[model samples]
Target: MAHDLTTPRDGIPPVLSTPASFREAAAALASGQGPLAIDTERASGFRYDDRAFLVQIRRRDVGTFLLDPEGHRTEFTAALAPVLNGQDWILHAAPSDLPSLAWLGLYPGSLFDTELGGRLAGLDHVNLAAMTELLLDVRLAKGHGAEDWSQRPLPANWLAYAALDVELLLELGDTMAEILDNQGKLDWASEEFEYIRNTHSTITGPAEATWRSVRGVASLTRPEQLAVARELWMIRESIAVEEDRAVSRILPNKVLIEIARLLPRTARELVRVKGFRRSEVRFWGEIIQRALESDPRTWPTRDRPPRGLPSRQTWAAEHPDSWERFSNARTLLDDLSADLAIPVENILKPAVLRTVAWGATVGREIRSPLDLPDVLRDYQARNWQVELTAPILTETLFR
Candidate 1:
């Protein structure tokens, strides 16, 4: 069955070739009446950003193919312009491949991210291989290696490994779709996929700020975070562009956040921050110190909300039922995810869960899907009610 299904072990492969080959394969693929399953593996270690050095695409009906962007002398900018322009590419965790694909001057018209789809469907383990095992009862061989794709004479084994990635995507998607449909979560999957496809292009180059990508950023005072982040980004940008290296390589986000948190005003103070790699400190310490020293007045002195905000313990004391309610809701969601075959984190993130707990405590509803504005709304509603009743609840309810 494998022999018949796959291109023979010996033969000129039918991947990207002349325009005629591309036309024929694309025509067959288009007629297959199934969404394509797509995956990308890139030399992330070698490159500054996550990109698809090799693209693997599979149509359930037509089999899988590997496209060597570095090979074929194929001007992808022109050759793949149309596919990027129109087709809805099914991807797993689409962001990793966005930079590289966007680099190819091919913007995917839409996307069907199976990983996100699985999450919305409520699957715990969304890794491609694991999903394949659960849905198809087939185990995929692990294919990662240190072999550099930029090298000449790419091994046949490597090619096969690459091709195998996409080969089962369409089938996997179909299986996942069946599960989603049965679970009545197909709309959720569609929402996630369409959200990915309709998103704006990723920002690259010096203008891009690392702060936008930083997690837990809102924990810091907005002005302090904003100024420190601006300075850190400028310094990182200058060095990254000059050295042609990744920003994280020079100074990881952890160190950057630590620096901001400490608000180091001098070289001496800067050295005390945790995990401040000496090499990085030596390289960019002065730049950071200078930013810190620039304006004591301008730097945010106000305490950030939620960092050391009033404890959940306070809330728990006032409304004893709140904790129980939150626990019940969380347990309910976790069990629901497991039963429904989705990841718990996908249904409601920890931050979102926090908002829900706080909201319900003060008599608020969690109606919005997981989003920043929705979370903010939850926080606002809960705080207003909690604050209003705080004195009474603390005195009468606690006593």
Candidate 2:
């Protein structure tokens, strides 16, 4: 029978805001036995920064402890370092949470990422709620995750929800670990976990180029409009950061694009646009007008954005032989993925595969599967990934 988890087993502990409270919670966690179940709540969609507002931790004997990292940012790290350092951490989707946790100076010595484990074990629907229900038969209440956690005086219900995040994490980790071990993929999972733990989290790409990632920027054909969109995006980003609000919340992409396309000259013209009609125009109308009024000569160039490789369309047209090799490699990879019950992307990244295929045919020596490491050094294909897929890749290239 399925059980609905409405409240934490030991009830929600008070938010650890003060240094003394952090020390007390750390003491309890230190004395507790077994792996630490950890989760963090960040104000991502609602705030400018992605820092963790609430850090939730649970262990076998020590119930649940929620630390308000914002309250004691300076001291929380040192207080919990001894208890958390080198301990096995149980988390679902460790990559999403690890970076924010690392920002607080907390790093796990080892970790079991339940979601990745489930994927490796060939289980679909690996999200926390789904996996918990499938493996442990517990239904977690959904929603409330997107709330602005930076708000003072967090609600009691929200606290309960945060505590529940870590409630079944360790249990889920154990179940996934056992399944991986039985399937002889435990070593593979361990390597993946270690990689996640050691990897530093940093934003990629130039700040100016970040605007290009807006939803519909690809549709704009003119360099002037593209420049307008870039300027508007930069302006919105600046306001969002200063106000500590989400960029989308400040101005939706659709409205921003419309403003660029029309190049609204005045506050009256700007507010006439769909999303800018309300308080947004009153607040940011001047800035938008200024951006649109900038000289066209100063617009961004029409050159394609920098990328590691060309698109598949360009590759197929430019180099048919290398494309043939890539196609064959993909087929082989699909078969290997099906046989191993792991996703093809997990087996080898698509970019790495393409790079290897191109290099293999273009005067690069790849006598055996073993030489893949040298060819893939820059690509950073892991040993486990290369070991499983290289033989097939080698055959595809040589044949």
Candidate 3:
């Protein structure tokens, strides 16, 4: 009963790039009667931060409108503000799309993330195409997601692919809602959707964590290498923000790590290193060499602060008691996950589990089972999550 969704039933319209086009599209969409099915194409890994280049919105009868938001921010916002206001939105994976949309001043009133709903409904594959196929019996054509959407005069095939992104979302949302309601997870999914709607980030560029997040930064053995990598990462990040380009596209992780590893002393030496073939490498080498030549006295400590409890690798040998508790907790949580038909991550954040185990045993942060609520709250565990998990963890950590 599955058919390939190669094109929109009404066909793809022209990209609404101009103010007049946006207004017309808005008027058409506003007249349609239903929640909006929305999706955005962002150049995250390929460009800078998640800035949306294309926004696709669909309604019951309005069909699909591909919005070109670049260089027309004001027009795009002004025209569509009234249309999107106070309307529920259906998005496949809400988190990735929401940030860029928020950057464009588009916020949802209510959200139904089909991907999350699929997880709550206990579906195996929670991606957009997978959920649509399972719940709507329609297979979507994909493979355009990784392309640079900022290109003008977008290809016909890519447009069709983008159109299909929102085309089935309305029916898919309805079908998913019915399943969630039948499975008695409607309230849970509602809570999740509301959480996503309320929480959005409009950050345009890298934050403090950018350098540390580089692929091979953690693997560099020497403190000097980390210092050099951090410096090089900052240079890449600054240029990425200024030009609105992706950091990796500007300076690949493989090349950056190699330069840092070699501790290249000059622009000439820097360019000679392996994996340094970019056209900009010679120019970037000068700026990078400055960081490498700086005094080592100012270098940061080699060890970055742990994100959470001591690394689990060390827990067994360095902190055996906490390791044992963590082991037991995982087993208990895994069994609970199976019983409730919810993924382990959906039941409780993995960080919360690790922190709770360490807190109760080694950290001595929990005095008794009564202390579980406050500890869990610190991690922003949802009320429903805390309710479902508190008793289970209280017994596990305390015992």
Candidate 4:
């Protein structure tokens, strides 16, 4: 029978807020036995920045400690460093929490990502709630994930929800590890967890022409409208950063795209746009007008070159022979994924595969699949990934 986890197995402790409290919690954790079960909650949709508002950790000996990093930032890291360093931190989705935790100067020397472990073990649903119920037979409460963690004095229920997140993480990790070992993919899971721990967050840099990512920007054919979209996007971003509000809360993409398309010249005209009649637009109307009224020459003439490779959809038309080879490689990858019960993307990223396929035919001396390691290395594929897929790619591409 599935059991509903109404509260922490060892009751929720008061949040450690002050320097003294943090130090005490840290000391307890440092002396605690076994790996630390770690998790973090962030106000992603409610705030502009993705900083952790609350961090929850658990250990067998130390019990559960909820640390509020927002106020005790300085003491939090110093106190927790001794415990977190060189410890196997077990987390459900490490990537989501790692960046925010790293921002506060806390990093794990090693980690066991249960989500990745589930993937390598070929479990269809790897979410915490699903995994917990499946492996540990406990139902986690839902509907608290999007709560505004930036708010002060978190409610009792919210605190309970937060503490419960790390409650079964250790158990889940152990069960998933056993499954992966039985499947003979424990090594693969270890490689994946290490990769997650060391890999950089994808959101580090300022994206170029971020306006282009808006939904309807492609429909705006005129340079003037594109310029308007860029200006409006920048203005919205500035407001979001200054007010610490999410850009979507300030103005939705649909509204911004509508303003760009209409090229509204005045506050009145801007308000006339379908989605711009909200109170937020009333406050930001002048800023939008200023962006639209700037001289056309002042608008951006062209977008910067995209940071990564171009879309693969164009490859067939641009290079038919290379496209054929890529298709063959993709087929082989599909077969491999099916045989191993792993996702195709996990076996090899499509972008890396495309680069190799295109390079094999154009301006490169890749004679056989054996030369794929050099190509894969240039593309930053790990040794384990190359070992698994290189042989198949060699046969498919070379023949």
**Model 4 CA lDDT for position 7:** 84
Over 307-371, each residue of candidate 1 has an lDDT whose tens digit, in order, gives 32136787678776776666666676666557766666655555655655555455455332233
**Candidate 4 Cα deviation (angstroms), residue 292:** 3.8
As a whole number from 0 to 100, the lDDT of residue 150 in candidate 2 is 89
Worst 10 residues of 2 by lDDT: 200-209
Q: Which residue ranges in model 4 land beyond 4 Å of their true spot?
A: 201-223, 266-269, 272-274, 280-283, 295-297, 304-314, 317-320, 362-368
- lDDT at 107, model 3: 81
lDDT (tens digit, per residue) of candidate 2 on 114-221: 999989998879888899899999998767788989898999889989999999998888899899999999999898888787774342222343887888887787
TM-score for candidate 4: 0.89
Cα lDDT tens digits for candidate 4, 172-261: 888988999999988888888887777733433333437788888877877778887887788888888899898888788898889878
Q: How many residue pairs in model 1 have overlapping backbones? A: 6
Clashes in predicted model 3: 2
Better of 1 and 4 by lDDT: 4
User: Would you estimate the TM-scores of all the predictions?
Assistant: 0.64, 0.87, 0.90, 0.89
Q: Order of all candidates by TM-score, from best down to worst? A: 3, 4, 2, 1
